[model samples]
Target: MNDQGQGITVVSLLLAGLLLYGGAGWLLDSWLGTRLFTPFGLILGSALSIYVIVKKMGGVKS
Candidate 1:
């Protein structure tokens, strides 16, 4: 369906944004020898993964 294609595009964009934003921050913190960014990376990755899983499971039925 047309909407399913759109969903894929949107999800891809979200994933890219999450990686560039959160991953960059995590890398910076890691370089500085701070562990705080590790948790942030995990949280960001988990939250985005959950969102995509829910979205794919017809959670958007409206």
Candidate 2:
């Protein structure tokens, strides 16, 4: 795939991660009557997505 395609894929992955995790967090907050999980979930999702992207893009060759 070309660079543009790769860029699009990365963006999509990031957005999906944020939405999926953030939405889960929001649901949890609604269910449990808390207001912290949303941010936490978003952070976790972004971090995990970054990790996945790094691995997929081939980080640090030995």
Candidate 3:
């Protein structure tokens, strides 16, 4: 895909990751009666998404 397409894909990936992980974390926190999982979930999601984006875009030369 082109740069514009890639940009959209990356953003979507990031948003999906954040929502998925964040929701999981919220659930975990609710179940465990703790408040530590939300931020961790967001961070982990962001990191994973960034890693995936870098891997996917590795072939693009600018």
Candidate 4:
């Protein structure tokens, strides 16, 4: 795939992960006893999403 395709994939993943993290956090805080910090969820989700993208992008690119 070209650069644009790769970029789209990464952006899609980031957005999906963000929505998932936010919804999960909201549900957990609302229903479960465990209280998760909102910012923490975003940070972790973004980090995880980027990690996956970088790994899939073939690690350190020259």
Top model number, TM-score:
3
lDDT per residue as tens, model 4, 1-62: 78999999999989977777766776777786666756667777787888888788966566
What tens-digit string does per-residue lDDT give for candidate 3 at 3-54?
Answer: 7999999999999889999889989999999999999999899988999999
Give every collision pair in model 1: none
Clashing pairs in 4: none
lDDT for model 4 comes to: 0.78
* Model 4 bad stretches (over 4 Å): 33-35, 60-62
Q: Which candidate, 1 or 4, has the higher lDDT?
A: 4
Q: List the residue pairs that clash in candidate 2.
A: none
TM-score of each: 0.49, 0.88, 0.90, 0.75
Q: Worst 10-residue stretch by lDDT in candidate 4?
A: 32-41
Clashes of 4: 0
- The local distance difference test score of each candidate is 0.70, 0.88, 0.91, 0.78
Q: After superposition, how far is residue 33 of candidate 1 from its true place, in Å?
A: 1.9
**Model 2 worst lDDT run, 10 consecutive residues:** 53-62
Say which prediction, candidate 3 or candidate 4, comes out ahead on TM-score.
Answer: 3
**lDDT-sorted candidate list, best first:** 3, 2, 4, 1
lDDT of 2 by residue, 1-62 (tens): 66798698799889988999999999999999999999999999898888888877755554
Instruction: Please name the candidate that would achieve the greatest lDDT relative to the true structure.
Output: 3
Give stretches of model 1 more than 4 Å off.
35-62
Which clashing pairs does model 3 show? none
* Residue 56 lDDT (model 3): 88
TM-score of candidate 3 against the unseen true structure: 0.90
